[model samples]
Target: MTETFITIFLVFMILAAVVALEARELLSTVIAVGAVGFMLSVIFLFLRAPDIAIVQIVVEILTLVILVRATISRDTHFFEDEREFFPFAINIVMIMVFLIFAFWAVKTLPRFGLNFSKVAPYYLTKGLAQTGAANIVTSVILDYRAYDTLGEATVLFTAVLGAVALLRRKAKAAENKNG
Candidate 1:
C-alpha cells in the first residue's frame, strides 16, 4: 500500500512540476506550485512524518498567499519572448540535470523501510525526558531543533515582509501618479 501511494504521488509531483514549468500565466504557475507542495506534504505524511508535512503545508500556504498578493496589482500573464534563446537553453539544461539526478536516485535510494534508522526511535523514546515536553512534535521542533526552526521562521518572515513592502511601494507609486 505504501509503495503504491508513493508511486502515485511521485507521478503527481512530476506532472505538477512540468505543468508549473509550462504554465503561461503566473497565477496558473502559482497554483501549480501549490499543487506540487500539496503533493509533497501528502508524501511526507505517507512516510509517517507529520512534522514535516505540517511544516510543508504551512509554508506552502504562506508562499501562495504572498505570491498572489504581490502579483495582484500587476499583469498575471507570463510573456515569453520567442526570440529568447538564453532562457530556453537554461531550461533545457535544467531538464537534463533533473533527468540525471532522477537516474542517480533510482539507482541509489534504499528500499522502503529497509534502512529504518535508529534516529526516529531514539527521538520518540527520549524526547519527553530530555526536553520536558509531553508533545513529541513540540519538543522535536521547539527544543531539539530550536535554532533551525528559528532560522526558518526568520527567513519566512523576511520574505513576507519583502513582499508586503513591494506591494505597498507599487501602490504608493500609483497613487502618487494619479493624485
Candidate 2:
C-alpha cells in the first residue's frame, strides 16, 4: 500500500513540477507548483514523517494564498508568452544540467529504504523521555529542532508582510487611477 501510494504521488509530483516549469500562464504555474507541493506532502506522509508533511502543507497553503492574492489584484486579460530570444538553447542547457545532477545522485546515493541514520532510533527511544512529548516526531521538531521551526515561521511572516505590502500598493495604484 505504501509503495503504491509512493509511486502514484511521485509520478504526480514529477508531472506537477514539469507543468509548473512549462506553463505559460502565471496562474497555471502557481497551481502546478501547489499541486507539486501537495504531492510532496503526501509523499512525506507515506514516508512516516507527518511533521515534515504538516509543515509542507502549511507552507504550500501560505504560498498559494499569496499567489492568489497577487493574481486577483492584477489584470488577468491575456496569457503571457514568456519565451526568450534563445529559449531553445537555454532549455537544452537546463535539461542537460538536470540530467547530469540526476545521474550523479543515482550513482552516489544509497538505495531507498535503507536506514540512513542512527538518530531515528535515538529519537524514538529517548525523545518522549527527554522532551515530555508523546509523539517522537513532535519531540524532534518542537524540542530538538525548535530553532529551525522558528526560522521557518519568521520567513513565512516576512512573506506574508511582503504580500500585504504589494497588495496595498496595487490598491493604491488603482485608487489613484480612478480618483
Candidate 3:
C-alpha cells in the first residue's frame, strides 16, 4: 500500500513537472509548478518529514503568487513560436538523463536507518534542550548551519535587487520615450 502510494505520488510529481515545462501559457505553467511542489510536499509528509513538507508548501504558495502577479502585470505574451519541437526534444532527453543520474545517486546513498539512527533520535530528544528552539526545523536550520541559511538569504536578496533595478531601468526608458 505504501509503495503504491509512493508510485502514484511520483507519477503525479513527474507529470506536473513535465507539464510545467511544456506549458505555453505562463499561468498554466505556474499552476503546474505549484502542483509539483504540492505533490512533493505530500510525499515528504508521507515520508515523515513534516518540516520539509511545510516549507515546501509555504514556498510553493509564495512563489506561485509572485509569478502569477508578475505574469498579470507584464505585457509579454506567454506563447512564442521561437520555442520549437527541437527544444522540447532536447529537454526530454536532458530530463531522462537527469532522472537516470538521480536514481543512480539515490541507490548509492547511505542507509539512514543503519548509519544515522542514533543521530536522528539524539537530535529529536536533545535538540530543544541544546538550541532552545521549539521547532526542530528552525533549530536545525538556524542553529546548526546558520551560515548556509545566511548565504541563501543573501543570494535571494541579490536576485530581488537585480530584478528591481532592471524593472526600474525599463520603466525609466519608457517614461523618457513617452515624455
Best by TM-score: 2
Angstrom error at residue 118, model 3 = 6.7
For model 2, state the Cα shift of residue 172 in Å. Answer: 11
Summarize candidate 3's per-residue lDDT along 102-144 as a digit string, tens digits.
9989998776435545677777889999999998878878988
Assess every candidate by TM-score: 0.69, 0.72, 0.71
Across 59-94, the per-residue lDDT of candidate 2 in tens digits comes to 999999999779768875345666676987898999
lDDT of 1 by residue, 31-90 (tens): 899999999999999998888899899999999999888777686767585647998899
Please give the distance, in angstroms, between residue 80's alpha carbon in candidate 2 and its true position after superposition: 4.8
Q: Could you give the C-alpha RMSD of every candidate to the true structure, in order shown?
A: 4.7, 4.7, 4.2
- True-vs-predicted CA distance for residue 162, candidate 1, Å: 6.7
Record all residue pairs in model 1 with backbone atoms less than 3 Å apart, i.e. clashing: none
Q: Rate the local accuracy (lDDT) of all candidates.
A: 0.88, 0.86, 0.86
